[model samples]
Target: MTALRSRVAETARVYRLHPPRVSLGRVVATPGALDVVRDHGVDLPGLLRRHASGDWGDVCAADAQANDLAADPACPARLLSAYDTAGGRLWVLTEADRSATTVLLPSEY
Candidate 1:
């Protein structure tokens, strides 16, 4: 699968058991923060709501300043998928990785 597809698959597999706590409602944050949502299990639409609900400038400005990986094009898309059965919180995805035997969390991102 493609990188984004891989991420989506991993997200789907991990989130079924655990749910997320908070969903950021800001649009201005880095792609990484939004990717964190993919890292959890949330979808694009949900993310859009979160973004539209908050400050897109605040959320995105820092990434532009630091040029963080969150600004990457794929990060945002990778996080949203059909597999987000749970809310797909980041912490939960991390914990699931520890519990499993796979390196679903790509080190590159």
Candidate 2:
């Protein structure tokens, strides 16, 4: 398998073995996110996995200045952000129960 896919699989396996403190939410892609997937050929699920795993940095409390991944440190993130290797930024918002997550580009918000 490709390295990226392998990493994703490994991350998934780790999560399966020991889930995070907060349950992972269902991942959905917005229209603009789909467009980004088409344009940048990103593995959206992998990106989401990385974010869910807290592999991302640069946390911000507010949606503003979210050109990159940002999350509130105090609370379980209602939202998470990350950037792909190609420099594409993505934002993920989780439901109150953390049962659902929506992935979108920064500009889409």
Candidate 3:
């Protein structure tokens, strides 16, 4: 457990050193997402931090590649990240224009 915690801490440090590639603009959460977070004690900010830092969480390879491309200022595409939580799955999306970021359950989307 200590080793696992150490690895997690090291990973977090790496992400912290890397700045967000795009602006989150306005952050909003759906009611369902809020309920899920509340029910499961989700760490919303930590998830968002990972998304912003390009961690991409549990996304598929193709989606991860798309997110990588989207990170490039010249090739802006929408950014999507999926994370599995105790409640279920949460998704975070940042628009291509960087106008907003939304947090929602897949059912809400």
Could you estimate the TM-score for every candidate? Answer: 0.23, 0.58, 0.87
Candidate 1 lDDT over 5-106, as tens digits, reads: 676565445444344322433224335545655665556443333222221212235433332232233343112211222333221111111221111112
lDDT of 1 at 98: 20
- Please give, for residues 1-109, the per-residue lDDT of candidate 2 as tens digits: 8885676567667755543334456777888888888887776766666566654423454543342233433444365655543436777666545788887777877
Ten contiguous residues with the weakest lDDT in model 3: 1-10
Best by TM-score: 3
In terms of lDDT, model 1 sits at 0.33
Q: Choose 1 or 3, whichever is better by lDDT.
A: 3
For every candidate, C-alpha RMSD to the true structure in Å = 16.1, 5.9, 2.3
Please give the lDDT score for candidate 2.
0.60
Worst lDDT 10-window in candidate 2: 64-73
Q: What is the lDDT of residue 38 in candidate 2?
A: 83
Clashes of each: 12, 1, 0
